[model samples]
Target: MKLQVTGSISELLTGISHLSEELNFTIGSDGYPISVVKRPGPIEVKNANGQGEICFEKKIHFYRALGLWLQNFEKSKEFHIVEHPQFETSGVMIDASRNAVLTTDGIQMLLRKMAVMGLNLAMLYTEDTYEVPEYPYFGYMRGRYSEIEIKICDDYAEELGIEMIPCIQTLAHLKEALKWNYSNEFRDTESILLAGEPKTYEFLRTIIKSATKPYRSNRIHIGMDEAHELGLGKYLELNGYHNRFEIMNQHLKQVIHITEDLDLKPMIWSDMYFRLASKVGNYYDKDATIPEEIIKMIPNVQMVYWDYYHTEESHYEKMLTMHKLLVDEPIFAGGLWTWNGIAPNYGKAFRTTEAALKANKKFGIKEVFATMWGDNGAETPIQTVLPGMQLYAEYTYHQEVGPEHLAERFEFCTGYHLEDFLLLNHFDETPGVMKDNLYESNPSKFLLWQDILIGLYDKNIEGFPIAQHYEKLIQPLHDAKGKNHDMNLLFHFYEELARVLSVKAELGINLKNAYDQADKDAVHACSEKLSSLRKDVEKLRLAHKKLWFSTNKPFGWEVLDIRYGGLLTRIHSAEERVQEWLDDPTVRIEELEAERLFYNGIYTFGEEGTLGRNLYHRIVSNSVFSD
Candidate 1:
């Protein structure tokens, strides 16, 4: 396909031209023609004679118009489609601070997808994963992006007509950056900065300047949320328990002054303000009240209200209403649900997006974006969140769209099947799982990483056929690799995940049951199965490692490597313990006698019952691990 461009839309041709190679389309005189036009209205596409005319209101709208045109290109003889975008600034915020920092190439790849989806905003959530010229240990051993890398990504986003804003932290969420010995002077606690300290403002200024230098956007997201230890650490020792609200407000004024000096607009997470107002310090407190003086003293910075877990529209509506009390118009940030576990939770993501975006529309909020946060090691492949992104894109333009329309648009934007991308969810959404999966249940992750000997989640899954569920998904995921072509790496990882879970899911249950029954033969079989499972674990680790390296920087893979090695060592331990028990019946297996309990403490093991956990440390043991 060939694109004829004019005015501002011409820059996007370079950004989207690569699609010619990826989508296997030839750009020639005889190829399909798309005339790009820019104006100030809804995205309008019309086909007449032999060429397609794509008229868009914004630069971001052009890419979306092109996608819509392509979706109906050859199928229809002649047609017209008009899509009106709801939000002014809508896109994604990739969590680069988590273990996985996307490579520059991967960021460019995603920009294309964002352009296709008609999203105009892009943010890289880098707490410490961006280079600070003066601080060498800011992102030590973390694959932090250099100035050149950030510049390249921002340039690519510009070509795609997307606003790439630098999302950095000026207050808390800097545990990785602050743990080094050099940070002792300014650090109040592990994660929070010493807000009252004189040097803290200087440090904040340096980081804020460094973070914004590579981007063209005048906007910066200054993360000031979840700073629970604001005055509880060294600040308490120095100031003798100062009021947290006063401390926070003073810190905000200092940070805002820096941003103002740099000629930039700043946005802060609204959680801290709401938390201080709440009776119990909850961000979503419905009855939370702010003192009249405090309300009058609120700064002019943008208040970003982020909600990811809500499955109900009423909760978003209620939260949005509360946010307005803080700021006249608040920017809404929803979650893409990629942070859950090894696989993306499409069910939870779709439910939350629909519910939240609808609330955003009803409230007349103009700005929105979904966050792809990588909590707990960031194991899930980022590309698996495509269908969820598509869902957000559809909701951005239409009040409502049918399943068939979403699927068709998805296939057009991404040359892959929606069902195949969705099949990745089967790892966790197995037989015992609920229809909506509202509880954030992630059995696949806990099952694979849990101590098989102790069997933490074994009792919860004793009666359910979870292993059989994984077995059923093995072949489909394995076969999907060839169908997806470029996505073979992701599917191969998924296939290996299914392979590992098929055996590992019920290994502890079978072994413990056999030990209780005094069935020496069944116990022996379980031991042999552990040996084979070790090989499968190794395969899964290699598959995941390969996939990670292909998309992300090599720095983060070490964290996951440690996790894989731990599971392998525990499996070997299980084998040795089982062998010792088989040889000497007199020496009893202490762990096998231990009783299993429900994962959520007291929930029944049936409908709507779920672990709702995604943290690996919690799944593996009750002891203290990573904090």
Candidate 2:
């Protein structure tokens, strides 16, 4: 693995060496001479005099070449390097606003991984996760990054040849910030900014200025998506009647002016414009059309068509084609599926990202990136999605990359087998079910957190055989416990979670049946199981705490504590109710016998507003014993 390099390639080798110690290289003229050549497309590598000579057109291409060499050497495969990047910018976006602000060390670890995978852009998707000098309550108590920390991150990324871009919400998704008294003057609704207010423009300018000040890249992402109720709230109360498009157009003009003044290029989610223009309220409607007048009103801001749901290549093809009709150059932001629950959905992410990348290549879309959103308290760690990230890198350069090649590259880059890492997705997959699409709705999460007395997901999971699935995962998880220390705790956490879910999933149904039969023996058995399950849940809590603190900041662990602690308290109450019911057969368990329960065809649990609905989507009501 010794090699001699010159010019930009030598610089690339130095950077790669800093990231990975597994790579061996020596500055000698004998073994391998890696050269840089100004080629039009794809890198060229030739073997001469028993030495490997690699040539590339750009520094990023050289990094990809080095990645190929490392993969070949590690896997004991032949050296074959021919890659050209599909997009000019390909990277990962870490959502910092969703309560899991990555520590500086975490950022460095990810940057190192990104460098090894030949990703050239990195975006910290900050909604309110950076220090704004004038706004004290902005990102307050949220572990936001300071200016010094941002500089360190930027410098480190620059050394690795990554363009660290700033992605901040300029319009909507500012619910956390809007909670402050100062933000009351600018709030139009719960989440969006006031469109035509003078104070709103001032707030936008300050936010844009503060966000762009830390990063070196002039490219900024002003997230303007999902502002559905844009001008219908307070703006409606004040301004009588006005066109929604007019409101958004004026708002965009004001925001773009601030970006221009700051010498920054701003990008926005194109969904809002599409949703507002189309007759149907769908963002991904294939035949959705935007009014030409409305399209003309938009400024020179880049449109980012963020699509993470569709799995078909034709869906992306139509979407990208529609996006191209709107703007000359549009960026495509795909999802890595890290926000699903406590684990990464690698299976769904892989298929969706592969299809999206192929569509991007076909449509000649230049810039592309995968978003790792931390929705719902950012429970899932970003490291769990390393396989998906590596896949993005693989598909960016090589169009025909197969799963085997991806797995090998993943091992070479991250020091873990792809199969071992993909076990994270197995917990979500229902056994013997072909198309068990969770659609970002994780059953394991709901089952683990569902009330034991109510058993919302209990009868719902009739044929899942979740207990057997969890039993099978225990040994494999124990085997992978030593692969990555940070991830070891995660594996152990899932194992504990599976153990708890196995019992919790069936406890409610079994307990209710025993109660209806008025069998003392069955009641006693259910009581014993409940007590043991409580102990197991307590152990899972401890493991969850350890796993949370191991890779994430301490700020967001409170959410886990709340959920787990709440479940623990409910279990104690469930035990009391069971004892009461057994002692005197007259005690009423209203939750177990609610009359107005409606079972949607899909969910055996109740519908959206029902007591047995999904835990992640709806808040668990206050305890029945509280009154």
lDDT of 2 at 174: 87
List where candidate 1 sits over 4 angstroms from the true fold: 2-9, 29-33, 601-608, 612-614, 624-627
Q: Candidate 1: lDDT of 331?
A: 96
lDDT of 1 by residue, 1-627 (tens): 554444445566686675556544555555666677777899999888976788887778887887777777758858999888888889999999888999999998888888888788999999999889799988988999999999999988998889999998888998998999878899999999998778898898999889999999999999999998898999889889887888888889988998999999999999998898888999988898877788777778999999988878999999998888878889999998897788888888888899999989999999999999999899889998788888888889999978999888888888888999999777777776776577777888889899988988887777899999999999999889988768999999999999899999999999999999989999999999999999999999999999999989999899899999999999999999999999997778888898877676432234465644647777788787855
Write model 2 residue lDDT over 5-115, tens digit each, in one string.
654454565576665563445556764565555557677655444455566766666666776665665544346556767778899898888888888878888988888
Worst 10 residues of 2 by lDDT: 604-613
Whole-model lDDT values for every prediction: 0.86, 0.77
Q: Candidate 1 at residue 110, lDDT?
A: 88
Give the runs in model 2 whose Cα sits over 4 Å from its true position: 1-10, 22-41, 45-50, 75-78, 432-438, 484-486, 583-588, 593-619, 622-627
Give the lDDT of residue 279 in candidate 1.
80
Give the count of colliding residue pairs in each prediction.
Answer: 0, 0
